[model samples]
Target chain A: MLLALLRRFGQMIFVMFGISVLVFLIFFVTPGADPAARIAGRNASPETLEAVRKSFGFDQPVWVQYLTMMKKLFVTQDLTSFVNRGWKVVPAVLDTIPVTLSLVIGAAILWVVFGMLVGLIAAATRGSWIDKLLMALGLVGCAMPVYWLGEMMNLVSQSRYHDTWLFSWVPPLGYKNLSDDPRGWFLTLVIPWFTLAILYIGLYGRVLRANLIEAMQEDYIRTARAKGLSETRILLRHALRTSLISFVTLFGLDFGALVGGAALLTEVVFGLQGVGKLTYDALQNLDLPVIMTTVIYASFFVVLANALVDVVYILIDPRVRSA
Target chain B: MLEVRDLRISFRTEHGRVQAIDGVSFDVGESEILGVVGESGSGKTISLLAVMGLINDPNARIEGSIKLRGRELVGLEPREMRKLRGREIAMIFQDPMTAMTPVYTIGWQIAEQIMAHEKIGKAAALARAVDLLAEVNIPNPREAIHRFPHQLSGGMRQRAVIAMALSCNPALLIADEPTTALDVTVQAQILDLIRKLRRDHKSAVVFITHDMGVIAEMADRVMVMYSGRIVERGTKAEILLEPRHPYTRALLDSIPPLEGEKPKRLRSIPGSPPSLFDLPKGCSFAPRCPSRFERCAERPALEGGKHAAACFLKVAS
Candidate 1:
């Protein structure tokens, strides 16, 4: 097991390295793009353009440039955003981590608990009115786009009924640091978490329900029944336990992506300055340093998530242990 | 003792109601082995599964009474049925490879059955699990208990399943073709283990199988089923040596002879059993019975003494 983990860790490092190189190459390969021109700002003096080029190493080999950028970003810790003169790229990215982490973690818990409950209820009461009702709700949740849902939520809570008792308790938009005031932090992030979680809850619930129904039909379930286990026990222990294998795999990928700035729609609508918002702004302004940092940061989470999934997979499934 | 009377099971489908088990009736006494032999779809497994209250299809309709130790089992709530299962009556199946939850250790699975009905602690239940393994003749029982189902061989897994069924010392043990998936040598060993377990536990055994050899080796009483109904039933010697129904005779004849002159070819019943959806109006076996006559126009009900045959010919003579 330790060896498997070590192997996965090794693979994660290589994957992150490959992603960084790929992102770097793609940034420079775009047609007629000039990092030096962009960094120097509009109508700059010729000498300023030369200085920017030399400072950013646009004149050096791509590998040497990559290495220098890595050194400035990690070793020297002084990499700054080219577009925003005094803004440090790493600190700005690091600052957004807490907000993004708070959003992703809260939404992940909400979706996992909500989705698994919906799936289990649907599977257990299959062919009943409750099953139909839950599945219909899940379908509606899935059909609505996250951005549209977020805006509609904002419209209702922030404007249309801002003074209503239901909406009064909802705090103003934007994130509050947890260490500053935990209650405010929770209240501030609650709506965004649900808005982000709705789509995944629908998707995951439907998938989990289908897998669980299939697992319930397995011969082992029959054996469980013969063992005189209660319906709840049989469903929880024998069926859902097996069904969660695929569910966990899906969760790992979704959680990783969300933490890596895929919650841009929710973050934007809620006015929370998360990594997703930072990435969005960097892309619009063509801030190469900030963009590179964000890309590498996102890839790191994704690789780590995959490694965590592999480890959890072995723990749950005995068949994988010997392999 | 267990008694099933007028037990009927049907499934509702788009095509119509399919009668899976039609008016089946039988009884088993304590410490006795009743062998039920039939081909696929004969409702052998279905009947036993129904008795265990394990068949939970929404479209299924089960009628009549199943009495264990004179307590009515039909119409019992799921909660009540669950209490009876694994405690009063336990089951083992044909494919041991898939019979157990793959994620659990064999000891944990065995202890689960014991812990389900008994008020035993985890440690005592686990220790008993090891003992059950040893009782089933699994080598290194202590070590084997910690292993998963897939880690064991086919024979070993079946033994583990048997040990689980015997964990609670159920009053009745239902073996649903338990040896069918095993090798011939392994099959004999499993049969021996069951016979020994039955003797030691003093539990009634309902052993379902398709092999007549298995029935002859393990059964005290035998029942021959065809198309969801018992065509013939009697003591093992009476059924094997003097089968009364044409279907029973045909089944016995199909077995290759072991002595004298070898036949040029083995005898096989000419026609296959009818589909449950569109069974013949009369005797279900009439289509395939060589001795079928005009009198077979009406369905024959099982009748007569302890040794009985559902036939117009009265082959009992």
Candidate 2:
């Protein structure tokens, strides 16, 4: 197990390196955005541009710049943003990461627990009116875009009736650090978390319901029932564990994608300054350092999420251990 | 001892109500092996399932009294029935490969059964599991316990399943074609293991199989089922040698002896068993019975002594 983890860690480093190089090439080597011109603004003279280029080491070989960037990012840990006038980028990332992390983590907990309960209820009452109603609600949740939903929620709770009983005490729509005030942080992000979780709650509930129904049909489940295990035990212990395998895999992939700026719509609608919003802003400003930093950050999360999923596979399924 | 009396099971299919098992009755005496012989869809599995009160499909309905040591099992609540299933009466399935959960190790799976009914610690359960594995003749039980179901061979998996069925020392063990998916040699070993375990545990067994050779070898009593009902039943020798019902006779003749030179044309039962949905009005086997007559328009009830057959022609003969 230790050897496998070490191998995976080594693979993670190589992947992160490849991702960093890709980000560098896309930002620097690409034709559309000129880092030299952007850093020296339109008012600067040709002499100032030459000096800026030389100081930033843009005059060096491309390979040398790449090596220097890697050394600064990994070894020296002094990654200065050219667009931000040589201000360090890592601190800015650290400031925003907790907000995003809390949002994702809270939303994950909400969706998983709520989805499982809804799924179990739906499956238990399959073909009943309750099952149909829950499934229809799930369909609506799946179809509605998160941004539209978030905006609608804000319009009602924040804009339309802030003092009304229904809207009273609603979160003010900004993220606060959990370390600063846990209660304030939770209250502030609660709506965003729910809004972000709605779609996944529906998707995961449906996936879980379908998988649970299928898992119950397995011969082993029948054997469990035959063994005189209580209905609750049979469903929870045998059926639920098998169904969770697919759910876990989906969660891993979806979490990684979300961390990679897929939740940009939610972040934008909620006015939260997460990686998604940061990446969007960097894209708009053509900020290479910020964009590259976000890319590397998101790639690390995606790869790390995949590694976590691989570890979970061993716990969820014995067959996967040898594989 | 277990007794299934006047058991009836039906399913509402698209076509109509399909009577899966119609008025089937049998008994498993103490330490006796009652072999239920039937082709697929002949209600052999359903009969045992009905007795266990495991039929939960909405379309299916069951009626009858399944008395285990004089306790009625049919109308008991699921919780009460479940308490009896693995503890008092255990069942092994046909496909050993799929019978065990894939996510857990063999030891954990068996230990789960032990812990389900007994108040035992994990360490003690593990020890009991290893002992059960060794009892089932799995080589290197200590090493094998840590291995998952897929790691074991087909025969080994079946042994593991048998070990689990016997873990609680159930009074009745229902093995539904336990060796159907195994090779001939492996099949023999499993049969031997089951017989040995039955002797060791002193538990009555209900063995379901279509193989006459297996039934002949392992069964003390035989119940020959056709068209969702027992056509003939008797001691193993009576059913094999003097099969009163034509269906039973046909089944016995169908088995080709291993020592003899192969017959150019082996005996095959004429016509298929009637579909449950479109069963004929009187005797279900009349269409396929060579000696069928007008009197067969009335269904024959089980008759004779300990060895009985539901046949109008046999009764007259």
Candidate 3:
């Protein structure tokens, strides 16, 4: 077990390194907008541009700049944003991290539990009216875009019924720090959480329902039932564990992708300043340093999520460990 | 000991109600190996499943009495039936590859059965699992316990399944073509294992297969089924040497000789078993039975001493 963990840790480091390099090359080496111009803004004079270029080491060789950036981001931890005019990006990221984390984490919990419940019910009653209805709901959830759904929700709750009991308690159009006011934080994110969760709940519940139904047909499940296991035990203990293999695979990749700023649409529509929003703004302003940092940050989550999935795979499946 | 009498099962399909098992009856005596030989869709597997109360199709209607040690099994609640399955009766399926859950280790899978029926802790159950694996002659039981079903070879997997079925020392073991998926050598090994298990545990076994050689090798008595009904049933010697039913004779004659001068023309059953939906009005197998008579338009009843056959010829004799 110790050896396996150590091996996984080593793989994680290698993946992180690869991702960091890719992010650096894509943002820095790729021919596109000038980092100097982006940092200096449109109105900077020649002297200011030269000063800004030299100060951030843009005048240095590409390899040297890459190494310097890596050192500042990892070794020294003194990275600052050229686009933000010398402001430290880490503290800014730290400020928004908790809110995004809360949103994703809460949505994930709701999606998994409620999705599985719906899926189990649908599968158990396979050909019944309830199954058909749940499946129809799943299709709607999968077909509707998250951004569109968020917009629709905002219009209905914020615009159409702002004075009504249903819409009166919606967040006041901004994120609140949990430390400053936990209630405000919850109220602010609750709508966004539900909005984000809607699409996933549908997709995941259908996938889970199909997988569980398939698992129930497996000979092992029949054996389990034959062994006198109750329907509940057979469903949860025997069938669910096996079906979760695919679910976990999808979850791992998705969690990483979401953390990597794939949730930008939802963040933008809801006015949440998540890493996704930060990355989008950085890209728009051609801010290389901020963009690179966000890329690295998102890459870290992706790589870390994959590593966690590997560990989870070994735990859930003995075949993997044995091999 | 288990007794099945006049068991009939039908399924509601798009065409109409298809009779899958028609008036099938057989008794598995204590410590006797009863071989059920038939091709696919012969209702052999479905018969055992009905006995276990695992049939879940909403359209399926089952009528019969399955008595195990005097208790009627047909009308019992699912919960009660479940309790009876692994405790008093157990089953090992045909495809060993899919017979056990893929995610859990063989030890965990076996231990699950033990824990389900008995109030045993993990440690004790695991220890018992290793012991059972060793009894089944798996090499390095300790190491093999942690390995998943996929890691094992076909033969090893079948052994693991058998070990699991025998975990609770069930009175009856229903092996639904257990060795069908295995190669010849593995098939022989598995058959040997089942024979040894029967002797060691003194458990009655209902071994389902299409191989006459397998039936000759393991069965004390044999039942030959075609189109969801028993065509012939007798002692292994009687069925192999003197098959009363033409379908049984055709099946025995169809086996290719392993080492001898080959026949110029291997005998083959003339036609396929009739589709369950459009079954012949009278005899189900009349189309395939070479000795079918004019009176075969009426269904024949099972007759003849302890060894019975559902045939007009046998009934007339």
DockQ of each: 0.79, 0.72, 0.69
lDDT of 1 at B7: 96
Backbone clash total for model 1 is 0
**Sliding window of 10 residues with minimal summed lDDT for model 3 chain A:** A82-91
lDDT of 3 by residue, B22-60 (tens): 999999999999999988888999999998888988999
Q: Put the candidates in DockQ order, highest first.
A: 1, 2, 3
Q: Which residue pairs come into collision in candidate 1?
A: none
Clash numbers, per candidate: 0, 0, 0
Interface RMSD score of each model: 0.6, 0.9, 1.3
Give me the candidate number with maximum lDDT. 1
TM-score comparison, 1 vs 2, better candidate: 1
**In candidate 2, which residue ranges exceed 4 Å CA deviation?**
A17-72, A75-84, A164-171, B118-131, B139-147, B289-301, B315-317
In terms of TM-score, the best-performing candidate is 1
lDDT of each: 0.91, 0.88, 0.86
Model 2 lDDT per residue over B102-164, tens place: 888889888888888899999899999899999999999998888889898999999999888
lDDT of 2 by residue, A52-151 (tens): 8899999998889988877777678788877677678777877778878888888999998989988999988889999999999988988999999999
Docking class of 2: medium
Model 3 misplaced regions, further than 4 Å: A1-84, A88-90, A148-171, B119-131, B138-147, B183-189, B257-266, B313-317
Q: What would the TM-scores of all predictions be?
A: 0.96, 0.90, 0.87
Evaluation by DockQ, superior candidate among 2 and 3? 2
